[model samples]
Target: MIERPIGRDVVARQRFARLFSLGDRRAPLSWSPGLVLGPDDPELPVSVAPLRSTRSYDSIPATITICPRDNLCYPFDSEDKWVAQEGLVLPPSLVASDSGMFGSGLEAVPVSWNSLHHDDSLAVLDSEPSVIILIDAPQLAQRPGMLAEALLTVRTRFPSSLIWAPGISGPDNCALLTWMGVDLFDLARLRHASSLGVLLTGSGPRKVEETVNEDFGMEAQCTTWVQAISSTRAAIREGTLRELV
Candidate 1:
Protein backbone atom coordinates (compact mmCIF):
# COMPACT_ATOMS: atom_id res chain seq x y z
CA MET A 1 0.00 0.00 0.00
CA ILE A 2 1.16 3.56 -0.62
CA GLU A 3 2.10 5.25 2.62
CA ARG A 4 1.24 8.88 3.12
CA PRO A 5 3.30 9.69 6.17
CA ILE A 6 2.50 13.36 5.93
CA GLY A 7 -0.21 15.42 4.25
CA ARG A 8 1.56 18.41 2.69
CA ASP A 9 3.79 21.29 3.73
CA VAL A 10 4.00 24.88 2.59
CA VAL A 11 7.76 25.05 2.95
CA ALA A 12 7.81 28.13 0.78
CA ARG A 13 4.69 29.90 -0.51
CA GLN A 14 4.21 32.92 -2.72
CA ARG A 15 1.93 34.29 -5.42
CA PHE A 16 2.77 31.41 -7.73
CA ALA A 17 5.79 29.91 -5.99
CA ARG A 18 5.42 26.94 -3.66
CA LEU A 19 7.85 24.44 -2.19
CA PHE A 20 6.23 21.38 -0.68
CA SER A 21 6.61 17.72 0.24
CA LEU A 22 4.53 14.65 -0.61
CA GLY A 23 4.36 10.88 0.23
CA ASP A 24 6.04 9.06 3.14
CA ARG A 25 8.58 10.95 5.25
CA ARG A 26 11.38 8.56 4.36
CA ALA A 27 10.95 9.22 0.63
CA PRO A 28 9.14 12.51 0.52
CA LEU A 29 9.22 14.44 -2.74
CA SER A 30 10.41 18.00 -2.18
CA TRP A 31 8.76 19.96 -4.92
CA SER A 32 10.29 23.18 -6.27
CA PRO A 33 13.40 22.67 -4.15
CA GLY A 34 16.05 21.88 -6.78
CA LEU A 35 17.52 18.84 -8.44
CA VAL A 36 16.43 15.49 -6.97
CA LEU A 37 19.04 12.73 -6.82
CA GLY A 38 18.45 9.33 -5.24
CA PRO A 39 20.04 5.91 -5.03
CA ASP A 40 18.99 3.70 -7.95
CA ASP A 41 16.36 1.09 -7.17
CA PRO A 42 16.67 -2.17 -9.07
CA GLU A 43 12.91 -2.28 -8.53
CA LEU A 44 11.48 1.22 -8.91
CA PRO A 45 8.53 2.17 -6.69
CA VAL A 46 5.08 2.95 -8.05
CA SER A 47 3.82 6.15 -6.40
CA VAL A 48 0.56 6.41 -8.35
CA ALA A 49 -0.78 3.45 -10.27
CA PRO A 50 -3.46 4.04 -12.87
CA LEU A 51 -5.73 0.99 -13.14
CA ARG A 52 -4.69 -1.22 -16.03
CA SER A 53 -8.23 -1.15 -17.42
CA THR A 54 -7.90 2.61 -17.82
CA ARG A 55 -4.83 2.29 -19.96
CA SER A 56 -5.01 3.88 -23.41
CA TYR A 57 -2.34 3.41 -26.04
CA ASP A 58 -3.31 6.43 -28.13
CA SER A 59 -2.53 9.04 -25.48
CA ILE A 60 0.42 8.94 -23.13
CA PRO A 61 -0.59 9.34 -19.49
CA ALA A 62 1.94 10.32 -16.82
CA THR A 63 2.30 8.45 -13.54
CA ILE A 64 4.09 10.00 -10.52
CA THR A 65 5.81 7.61 -8.12
CA ILE A 66 7.52 8.37 -4.81
CA CYS A 67 9.69 5.70 -3.20
CA PRO A 68 10.56 5.14 0.47
CA ARG A 69 14.07 6.54 -0.05
CA ASP A 70 12.88 9.60 -1.98
CA ASN A 71 13.27 8.24 -5.49
CA LEU A 72 10.78 9.84 -7.86
CA CYS A 73 9.50 8.44 -11.13
CA TYR A 74 7.17 10.14 -13.62
CA PRO A 75 6.82 7.23 -15.95
CA PHE A 76 4.30 7.39 -18.76
CA ASP A 77 1.52 4.80 -19.24
CA SER A 78 3.84 2.90 -21.57
CA GLU A 79 6.53 2.50 -18.90
CA ASP A 80 4.31 1.39 -15.99
CA LYS A 81 5.18 -2.30 -16.11
CA TRP A 82 8.89 -1.76 -16.58
CA VAL A 83 8.96 0.69 -13.66
CA ALA A 84 6.96 -1.54 -11.31
CA GLN A 85 9.13 -4.57 -12.10
CA GLU A 86 12.23 -2.73 -10.88
CA GLY A 87 11.10 -1.79 -7.35
CA LEU A 88 8.76 -2.25 -4.38
CA VAL A 89 5.49 -1.04 -5.86
CA LEU A 90 3.15 1.04 -3.73
CA PRO A 91 -0.35 1.29 -5.15
CA PRO A 92 -1.67 4.84 -4.97
CA SER A 93 -4.80 5.75 -3.06
CA LEU A 94 -7.66 6.22 -5.52
CA VAL A 95 -9.58 9.50 -5.74
CA ALA A 96 -12.70 9.79 -7.88
CA SER A 97 -13.67 12.78 -10.03
CA ASP A 98 -15.86 13.82 -12.98
CA SER A 99 -12.72 14.02 -15.05
CA GLY A 100 -12.38 10.30 -14.53
CA MET A 101 -13.93 9.99 -17.98
CA PHE A 102 -10.34 10.09 -19.15
CA GLY A 103 -9.70 7.00 -17.06
CA SER A 104 -11.32 5.38 -14.07
CA GLY A 105 -9.45 4.46 -10.86
CA LEU A 106 -6.79 7.14 -11.20
CA GLU A 107 -4.64 8.37 -8.35
CA ALA A 108 -4.81 11.95 -9.56
CA VAL A 109 -7.99 13.17 -11.27
CA PRO A 110 -7.75 14.59 -14.81
CA VAL A 111 -9.06 18.08 -15.51
CA SER A 112 -10.10 19.20 -18.96
CA TRP A 113 -10.71 22.94 -18.68
CA ASN A 114 -12.11 23.36 -22.14
CA SER A 115 -14.42 20.38 -22.00
CA LEU A 116 -16.65 21.83 -19.31
CA HIS A 117 -18.26 25.17 -18.63
CA HIS A 118 -16.84 27.40 -15.89
CA ASP A 119 -19.18 26.04 -13.22
CA ASP A 120 -18.81 22.48 -14.39
CA SER A 121 -15.05 22.90 -14.47
CA LEU A 122 -15.05 24.22 -10.92
CA ALA A 123 -17.04 21.18 -9.82
CA VAL A 124 -14.15 18.90 -10.77
CA LEU A 125 -11.98 20.78 -8.30
CA ASP A 126 -14.34 19.76 -5.50
CA SER A 127 -12.90 16.24 -5.40
CA GLU A 128 -9.72 17.89 -4.10
CA PRO A 129 -7.08 15.48 -5.33
CA SER A 130 -3.51 15.96 -4.08
CA VAL A 131 -2.40 16.09 -7.67
CA ILE A 132 -4.43 17.27 -10.68
CA ILE A 133 -3.32 16.28 -14.18
CA LEU A 134 -4.21 18.60 -17.03
CA ILE A 135 -5.69 16.50 -19.83
CA ASP A 136 -4.68 17.28 -23.40
CA ALA A 137 -2.15 19.79 -22.16
CA PRO A 138 -0.75 20.47 -25.60
CA GLN A 139 -4.15 21.66 -26.72
CA LEU A 140 -4.62 23.64 -23.54
CA ALA A 141 -1.32 25.37 -24.11
CA GLN A 142 -2.81 26.86 -27.24
CA ARG A 143 -5.36 28.66 -25.06
CA PRO A 144 -2.98 30.37 -22.70
CA GLY A 145 -5.67 32.46 -21.06
CA MET A 146 -7.84 29.43 -20.32
CA LEU A 147 -4.89 27.43 -19.15
CA ALA A 148 -3.77 30.22 -16.86
CA GLU A 149 -7.26 30.66 -15.48
CA ALA A 150 -7.70 26.97 -14.80
CA LEU A 151 -4.30 26.72 -13.13
CA LEU A 152 -4.97 29.75 -10.95
CA THR A 153 -8.35 28.40 -9.94
CA VAL A 154 -6.86 25.10 -8.87
CA ARG A 155 -4.11 26.89 -6.95
CA THR A 156 -6.69 28.93 -5.10
CA ARG A 157 -9.17 26.14 -4.35
CA PHE A 158 -6.92 23.16 -3.74
CA PRO A 159 -3.84 24.87 -2.43
CA SER A 160 -2.51 21.65 -1.01
CA SER A 161 -2.36 19.57 -4.23
CA LEU A 162 0.49 19.63 -6.72
CA ILE A 163 -0.44 20.48 -10.31
CA TRP A 164 0.98 18.23 -13.01
CA ALA A 165 1.03 19.04 -16.73
CA PRO A 166 2.25 16.21 -18.91
CA GLY A 167 3.80 16.57 -22.35
CA ILE A 168 4.37 20.27 -21.75
CA SER A 169 7.89 20.85 -20.45
CA GLY A 170 10.78 22.34 -22.39
CA PRO A 171 13.46 25.04 -22.02
CA ASP A 172 10.91 27.57 -23.26
CA ASN A 173 8.11 26.90 -20.71
CA CYS A 174 9.42 24.99 -17.66
CA ALA A 175 10.15 28.11 -15.62
CA LEU A 176 6.82 29.66 -16.40
CA LEU A 177 4.92 26.53 -15.36
CA THR A 178 6.89 26.27 -12.10
CA TRP A 179 6.16 29.90 -11.37
CA MET A 180 2.49 29.10 -11.94
CA GLY A 181 2.50 26.37 -9.23
CA VAL A 182 3.04 23.25 -11.32
CA ASP A 183 5.20 20.86 -9.31
CA LEU A 184 5.53 17.75 -11.48
CA PHE A 185 6.68 17.72 -15.13
CA ASP A 186 7.09 14.79 -17.49
CA LEU A 187 10.03 14.51 -19.93
CA ALA A 188 7.83 13.64 -22.93
CA ARG A 189 8.52 16.95 -24.66
CA LEU A 190 12.25 16.60 -24.26
CA ARG A 191 12.14 13.08 -25.65
CA HIS A 192 10.03 14.25 -28.56
CA ALA A 193 12.40 17.10 -29.32
CA SER A 194 15.34 14.73 -29.27
CA SER A 195 13.59 12.40 -31.73
CA LEU A 196 13.22 15.36 -34.09
CA GLY A 197 16.98 15.88 -33.93
CA VAL A 198 16.54 19.05 -31.87
CA LEU A 199 18.88 20.12 -29.09
CA LEU A 200 17.19 21.86 -26.20
CA THR A 201 19.31 24.75 -24.88
CA GLY A 202 18.61 27.47 -22.33
CA SER A 203 17.56 29.88 -25.07
CA GLY A 204 15.33 27.30 -26.84
CA PRO A 205 15.33 24.20 -29.01
CA ARG A 206 17.83 24.09 -31.91
CA LYS A 207 18.06 21.68 -34.81
CA VAL A 208 21.12 19.47 -34.36
CA GLU A 209 21.38 18.94 -38.12
CA GLU A 210 21.82 22.72 -38.48
CA THR A 211 24.55 22.71 -35.82
CA VAL A 212 28.09 21.27 -35.87
CA ASN A 213 27.28 17.88 -34.30
CA GLU A 214 24.74 15.57 -35.92
CA ASP A 215 25.41 12.99 -33.25
CA PHE A 216 23.55 14.74 -30.40
CA GLY A 217 21.07 12.45 -28.67
CA MET A 218 18.13 12.51 -26.21
CA GLU A 219 20.37 11.71 -23.21
CA ALA A 220 22.31 14.94 -23.69
CA GLN A 221 19.09 16.89 -24.25
CA CYS A 222 17.59 15.35 -21.09
CA THR A 223 20.65 16.41 -19.13
CA THR A 224 20.23 19.95 -20.38
CA TRP A 225 16.58 19.94 -19.28
CA VAL A 226 17.53 18.53 -15.89
CA GLN A 227 20.03 21.33 -15.40
CA ALA A 228 17.44 23.85 -16.42
CA ILE A 229 14.96 22.39 -13.90
CA SER A 230 17.66 22.51 -11.23
CA SER A 231 18.30 26.17 -11.95
CA THR A 232 14.57 26.90 -11.92
CA ARG A 233 14.12 25.13 -8.59
CA ALA A 234 17.02 27.09 -7.12
CA ALA A 235 15.40 30.28 -8.25
CA ILE A 236 12.15 29.20 -6.54
CA ARG A 237 13.96 28.44 -3.27
CA GLU A 238 15.71 31.80 -3.43
CA GLY A 239 12.31 33.50 -3.90
CA THR A 240 13.35 34.81 -7.30
CA LEU A 241 11.25 32.41 -9.36
CA ARG A 242 9.28 35.24 -10.89
CA GLU A 243 12.48 36.80 -12.11
CA LEU A 244 13.19 33.72 -14.17
CA VAL A 245 9.72 33.94 -15.72
Candidate 2:
Protein backbone atom coordinates (compact mmCIF):
# COMPACT_ATOMS: atom_id res chain seq x y z
CA MET A 1 0.00 0.00 0.00
CA ILE A 2 1.28 3.46 -0.78
CA GLU A 3 1.89 5.64 2.29
CA ARG A 4 -0.12 8.75 1.67
CA PRO A 5 0.39 11.76 3.92
CA ILE A 6 -2.24 13.15 6.27
CA GLY A 7 -4.29 15.41 4.03
CA ARG A 8 -7.66 16.22 2.48
CA ASP A 9 -8.50 15.95 -1.20
CA VAL A 10 -11.53 17.36 -2.95
CA VAL A 11 -13.05 14.68 -5.16
CA ALA A 12 -16.11 16.71 -6.17
CA ARG A 13 -17.46 20.21 -5.81
CA GLN A 14 -20.65 22.16 -6.36
CA ARG A 15 -20.01 25.80 -5.66
CA PHE A 16 -19.14 25.89 -1.91
CA ALA A 17 -20.45 22.34 -1.50
CA ARG A 18 -17.47 19.97 -1.23
CA LEU A 19 -17.02 16.23 -1.52
CA PHE A 20 -13.68 15.38 0.00
CA SER A 21 -11.79 12.38 1.35
CA LEU A 22 -9.27 12.80 4.13
CA GLY A 23 -7.13 10.85 6.60
CA ASP A 24 -4.78 7.99 5.66
CA ARG A 25 -5.34 6.38 2.28
CA ARG A 26 -5.56 3.01 4.00
CA ALA A 27 -8.89 4.00 5.55
CA PRO A 28 -9.82 7.36 4.22
CA LEU A 29 -12.92 9.14 5.60
CA SER A 30 -14.97 10.78 2.88
CA TRP A 31 -17.71 13.42 3.03
CA SER A 32 -19.19 16.69 1.91
CA PRO A 33 -19.57 19.70 4.20
CA GLY A 34 -22.54 19.61 6.57
CA LEU A 35 -22.07 15.89 6.96
CA VAL A 36 -23.03 14.99 10.55
CA LEU A 37 -21.99 11.85 12.39
CA GLY A 38 -24.63 9.69 13.95
CA PRO A 39 -24.08 6.98 16.59
CA ASP A 40 -22.19 4.66 14.22
CA ASP A 41 -20.17 6.92 11.98
CA PRO A 42 -16.40 6.35 11.71
CA GLU A 43 -14.59 8.84 13.88
CA LEU A 44 -11.45 10.48 15.20
CA PRO A 45 -11.61 9.42 18.86
CA VAL A 46 -9.24 10.84 21.51
CA SER A 47 -8.48 8.73 24.56
CA VAL A 48 -6.04 7.96 27.38
CA ALA A 49 -4.42 4.97 25.63
CA PRO A 50 -4.05 6.93 22.44
CA LEU A 51 -1.44 4.54 21.03
CA ARG A 52 -2.79 1.12 22.02
CA SER A 53 -6.38 2.17 21.43
CA THR A 54 -5.72 2.91 17.79
CA ARG A 55 -4.07 -0.51 17.43
CA SER A 56 -7.33 -2.12 18.58
CA TYR A 57 -9.36 0.05 16.21
CA ASP A 58 -7.44 -1.43 13.23
CA SER A 59 -9.78 -4.43 13.29
CA ILE A 60 -12.66 -2.05 12.62
CA PRO A 61 -12.99 -0.97 9.01
CA ALA A 62 -12.48 2.61 7.77
CA THR A 63 -12.11 4.42 11.11
CA ILE A 64 -9.98 7.57 11.38
CA THR A 65 -7.95 7.73 14.60
CA ILE A 66 -6.07 10.75 15.84
CA CYS A 67 -3.88 10.91 18.96
CA PRO A 68 -4.14 13.78 21.32
CA ARG A 69 -1.02 15.81 22.09
CA ASP A 70 0.93 13.89 19.44
CA ASN A 71 3.63 16.41 20.20
CA LEU A 72 6.20 15.12 22.67
CA CYS A 73 6.03 18.30 24.69
CA TYR A 74 2.28 17.96 25.36
CA PRO A 75 0.98 14.93 27.22
CA PHE A 76 -2.51 13.40 27.27
CA ASP A 77 -2.86 13.79 31.02
CA SER A 78 -0.97 15.28 33.90
CA GLU A 79 -0.68 11.79 35.35
CA ASP A 80 1.04 10.71 32.16
CA LYS A 81 2.91 13.96 31.73
CA TRP A 82 6.00 12.26 30.43
CA VAL A 83 4.24 10.05 27.88
CA ALA A 84 4.05 10.89 24.20
CA GLN A 85 1.39 9.36 21.86
CA GLU A 86 3.30 9.88 18.60
CA GLY A 87 3.95 6.14 18.25
CA LEU A 88 0.21 5.45 18.00
CA VAL A 89 -0.60 3.45 14.87
CA LEU A 90 -3.21 5.53 13.11
CA PRO A 91 -4.18 6.56 9.62
CA PRO A 92 -1.50 9.05 8.52
CA SER A 93 -4.45 11.21 7.55
CA LEU A 94 -5.20 11.82 11.23
CA VAL A 95 -2.87 14.65 12.15
CA ALA A 96 0.61 16.03 11.72
CA SER A 97 -0.81 19.43 12.61
CA ASP A 98 0.71 22.65 13.79
CA SER A 99 0.44 24.16 17.27
CA GLY A 100 -1.70 27.16 18.09
CA MET A 101 -3.71 28.37 21.14
CA PHE A 102 -4.42 24.74 22.07
CA GLY A 103 -0.71 23.81 22.14
CA SER A 104 -1.56 20.54 20.37
CA GLY A 105 -4.07 18.89 22.72
CA LEU A 106 -5.93 17.43 19.73
CA GLU A 107 -5.14 16.04 16.28
CA ALA A 108 -6.06 19.37 14.74
CA VAL A 109 -5.16 22.62 16.42
CA PRO A 110 -8.10 24.17 18.33
CA VAL A 111 -8.95 27.71 17.30
CA SER A 112 -11.91 30.08 17.33
CA TRP A 113 -13.22 33.01 15.31
CA ASN A 114 -12.53 35.23 18.30
CA SER A 115 -8.84 34.86 17.56
CA LEU A 116 -9.13 36.98 14.45
CA HIS A 117 -9.64 40.17 16.43
CA HIS A 118 -6.88 39.40 18.92
CA ASP A 119 -3.11 39.06 18.81
CA ASP A 120 -3.20 35.26 19.35
CA SER A 121 -4.40 34.77 15.79
CA LEU A 122 -0.94 35.65 14.48
CA ALA A 123 0.37 32.26 15.55
CA VAL A 124 -2.45 30.46 13.71
CA LEU A 125 -2.13 32.64 10.61
CA ASP A 126 1.61 32.05 10.56
CA SER A 127 1.35 28.24 10.80
CA GLU A 128 -0.79 28.08 7.64
CA PRO A 129 -2.24 24.75 8.73
CA SER A 130 -3.87 22.34 6.30
CA VAL A 131 -6.57 21.44 8.85
CA ILE A 132 -8.08 23.11 11.91
CA ILE A 133 -10.77 22.28 14.49
CA LEU A 134 -13.23 24.98 15.45
CA ILE A 135 -13.48 25.02 19.26
CA ASP A 136 -16.28 27.54 19.66
CA ALA A 137 -18.80 26.08 17.27
CA PRO A 138 -21.49 25.77 19.93
CA GLN A 139 -20.98 29.37 20.96
CA LEU A 140 -21.03 30.50 17.36
CA ALA A 141 -24.30 28.63 16.85
CA GLN A 142 -25.81 30.37 19.86
CA ARG A 143 -25.37 33.81 18.36
CA PRO A 144 -27.61 34.93 15.52
CA GLY A 145 -25.09 35.20 12.66
CA MET A 146 -21.55 34.88 13.96
CA LEU A 147 -21.24 31.24 12.99
CA ALA A 148 -21.75 31.85 9.27
CA GLU A 149 -19.43 34.83 9.17
CA ALA A 150 -16.75 32.92 11.02
CA LEU A 151 -17.13 29.99 8.69
CA LEU A 152 -16.72 32.27 5.68
CA THR A 153 -13.67 33.95 7.23
CA VAL A 154 -11.90 30.68 7.91
CA ARG A 155 -12.69 29.43 4.41
CA THR A 156 -11.12 32.56 3.03
CA ARG A 157 -8.15 32.35 5.35
CA PHE A 158 -7.21 28.73 4.83
CA PRO A 159 -8.81 28.25 1.42
CA SER A 160 -7.13 24.85 1.18
CA SER A 161 -7.18 23.00 4.52
CA LEU A 162 -10.26 21.18 5.77
CA ILE A 163 -12.26 22.74 8.64
CA TRP A 164 -13.78 20.68 11.44
CA ALA A 165 -16.40 21.98 13.89
CA PRO A 166 -16.76 19.10 16.24
CA GLY A 167 -19.71 18.40 18.61
CA ILE A 168 -21.79 21.30 17.39
CA SER A 169 -24.18 20.00 14.74
CA GLY A 170 -26.79 17.43 13.86
CA PRO A 171 -30.04 17.43 11.80
CA ASP A 172 -30.62 20.89 13.22
CA ASN A 173 -28.29 23.05 11.14
CA CYS A 174 -26.36 20.66 8.96
CA ALA A 175 -27.70 22.21 5.75
CA LEU A 176 -27.04 25.76 6.87
CA LEU A 177 -23.50 24.97 7.94
CA THR A 178 -22.84 22.93 4.81
CA TRP A 179 -23.95 25.91 2.81
CA MET A 180 -21.51 28.01 4.83
CA GLY A 181 -18.61 25.54 4.20
CA VAL A 182 -17.90 23.40 7.28
CA ASP A 183 -16.01 20.34 6.09
CA LEU A 184 -16.67 18.11 9.12
CA PHE A 185 -18.90 17.46 12.15
CA ASP A 186 -19.42 14.70 14.72
CA LEU A 187 -22.25 12.83 16.51
CA ALA A 188 -21.39 14.01 20.00
CA ARG A 189 -24.44 16.25 20.12
CA LEU A 190 -26.77 13.58 18.82
CA ARG A 191 -25.49 11.00 21.28
CA HIS A 192 -25.81 13.44 24.12
CA ALA A 193 -29.40 14.27 23.25
CA SER A 194 -30.33 10.60 22.99
CA SER A 195 -29.00 10.01 26.46
CA LEU A 196 -31.19 12.83 27.70
CA GLY A 197 -34.38 11.22 26.38
CA VAL A 198 -34.60 13.57 23.43
CA LEU A 199 -35.11 12.56 19.81
CA LEU A 200 -33.50 14.82 17.25
CA THR A 201 -34.99 15.44 13.82
CA GLY A 202 -34.39 17.72 10.87
CA SER A 203 -37.07 20.03 12.19
CA GLY A 204 -35.86 20.13 15.83
CA PRO A 205 -35.31 18.17 18.99
CA ARG A 206 -38.35 16.48 20.51
CA LYS A 207 -38.68 14.78 23.87
CA VAL A 208 -38.89 11.04 23.32
CA GLU A 209 -42.03 9.73 24.95
CA GLU A 210 -41.97 6.13 26.07
CA THR A 211 -45.77 6.02 25.95
CA VAL A 212 -45.64 6.55 22.19
CA ASN A 213 -43.48 3.46 21.47
CA GLU A 214 -40.62 5.62 20.36
CA ASP A 215 -37.33 3.79 20.42
CA PHE A 216 -34.46 5.53 22.15
CA GLY A 217 -31.96 2.73 21.74
CA MET A 218 -28.56 3.16 20.15
CA GLU A 219 -29.76 1.42 17.02
CA ALA A 220 -32.59 3.89 16.70
CA GLN A 221 -30.22 6.79 17.18
CA CYS A 222 -27.91 5.44 14.52
CA THR A 223 -30.82 5.14 12.12
CA THR A 224 -31.69 8.77 12.64
CA TRP A 225 -28.12 9.74 11.84
CA VAL A 226 -28.00 7.61 8.69
CA GLN A 227 -31.15 9.25 7.37
CA ALA A 228 -30.03 12.78 8.12
CA ILE A 229 -26.55 12.34 6.65
CA SER A 230 -27.85 10.52 3.62
CA SER A 231 -30.45 13.13 2.75
CA THR A 232 -27.97 15.98 3.24
CA ARG A 233 -25.40 14.26 1.01
CA ALA A 234 -28.02 13.67 -1.63
CA ALA A 235 -29.10 17.27 -1.40
CA ILE A 236 -25.54 18.41 -1.96
CA ARG A 237 -25.26 16.21 -5.03
CA GLU A 238 -28.66 17.22 -6.38
CA GLY A 239 -28.03 20.90 -5.77
CA THR A 240 -31.20 21.16 -3.69
CA LEU A 241 -29.68 21.56 -0.21
CA ARG A 242 -30.00 25.30 -0.50
CA GLU A 243 -33.65 24.86 -1.26
CA LEU A 244 -34.18 23.12 2.08
CA VAL A 245 -32.99 26.21 3.90
Query: Candidate 1, residues 1-245: lDDT per residue as tens digits?
Result: 33232234566665676766543334544444232112221121222211111223343443334322333323211222111111111112122223233322223555555323322434554355545556556666775476677678767876776676666767667788888777766556666677787887777887776455554475676566667777776776777877778
Q: Which parts of model 2 are misplaced by more than 4 Å?
A: 1-5, 23-29, 34-107, 119-130, 209-212
> What lDDT does model 2 reach?
0.52
The TM-score values for the models, in the order shown, are 0.65, 0.63
lDDT (10s digit) by residue, model 2, range 40-70: 5444322111111121234322233333222
Instruction: Please give the CA lDDT of all the candidate structures.
Output: 0.51, 0.52
* Model 1 TM-score (2 dp): 0.65
Strongest candidate by TM-score: 1
Clashing pairs in 1: 27-70, 42-86, 43-86, 43-87, 44-86, 44-87, 47-65
